[model samples]
Target: MGPAERSVLVAWSTFTTTFTATRAVTHWIRDGHGPASGGITVGGRHFHHYNIGIALLSAVGAVALRGQERHRRHPVTAMAYGAANALIVDELMLLLDLKDVYWAKDGRTSVDAAVGLIGVGGIYLAAAPFWHRAARELASTAVHRPA
Candidate 1:
């Protein structure tokens, strides 16, 4: 595969892994099965993962846009981008509503959003080669067939 395609595949893999791991860990914590206390806190404010995701995304995006090709296509950069995306998606509902609804019924939208993104990404990656082939085949048939 080309470098760009390889980078995308790496990113997609990272995104899926990060998303799944985040969900599992959060569930464990929420269920009170872990040793750690509640959410991360500095002073009196609770820090959310999405906040980190946004910062990482901004940094990564800037570097990718202005850095050298090698830097932009690096696996590390891809992983960071993927993980950032997952973190943001994991809290989509909260972002939409501007409130903490992580365990509420309204929070289900976050899961739905994550699933939708993962499915779309998976389909695109899996069908990448087929898409080009299908397009070529259709073009050839059109060229040879009567109008």
Candidate 2:
């Protein structure tokens, strides 16, 4: 309802979309169904998705901390943060394994992580108001009720 809550919803949606799209595209390419080009390569080294995610996150943080007031709450920043988070989360297994296993069975870990994040985010958003109300009531009872 409030701006903060709305922003969170938007960010979550963005994250979900980015995560799903990235996974789908990667899987398609891995299955030899997409373009011949595997991915971006620079200077004989392949750039991972997480690398771009990190850069986007850094840019978002820098802009949020140093840019003008109008830039702080911009939707672009929120979307960037979401996409960055997705990219990083999608590579959880790769990071842990320290190798390219994205197309292997182990790669399912990324899907699990992404699904878990979505579930948790949804639960948190849905229950936050109830939690806040309960906390408020508890505080009021502590202050007003006899000891």
Candidate 3:
């Protein structure tokens, strides 16, 4: 409806898309449905998705904070931030324990957290308009009501 609303919608959509896509790709790789070797491995150390995620996030942050107006609202920056965040959060358990437990029982926490984040984001986006309206009404009433 307005610039703020449009921005929120675009941001939420981008984040959700990136998050879902990242999770799906991670699942595929974990299930051996992706690359033949699961993922890139070098020197007996397997590279995790979050590694690239962190890099992308850092790049996005750098660009966004470069004092360039055009770069701040760039779709690419938003997308990269969302995707990077998804990748990092998808491996929350691994990051915490410093071990691969993607298929282990505790790994479910990562999935839960990701899903919860998505759900909360969606709810906030959907309710933002109402929230704005309610805030305005409350302020108006407070100002107009008897003191």
User: What TM-score would candidate 2 get against the native?
Assistant: 0.88
- lDDT (Cα atoms) of all candidates against the true structure: 0.89, 0.87, 0.79
| Better candidate by lDDT, 1 or 2 | 1
User: Candidate 3, residues 1-147: lDDT per residue as tens digits?
Assistant: 864455556666766787688767766776878554477787877888889889998998798678487776666666677778788888889999888887799988988988898899889988988998999999999999996
TM-score per candidate, in order? 0.89, 0.88, 0.85
lDDT of 1 by residue, 1-147 (tens): 888889899989998999999899888877877665576777889888998889989989988789887899999899999999999999988999999998899999998988888899999999999998899999999999996
Clash pairs (backbone) in predicted model 2: none
Per-residue error (Å), model 3, residue 104? 0.8
Ten residues in a row with the worst lDDT in model 2? Answer: 28-37
Error of 2 at 5 (Å): 1.4
Model 2 agreement with the true structure over 83-124: per-residue lDDT tens digits:
999999998889999998887899889889999999999999
Error of 1 at 111 (Å): 0.5
lDDT of 2: 0.87
Give the Cα error of residue 141 in candidate 2, in Å. Answer: 2.2
**Which candidate number has the best lDDT?**
1
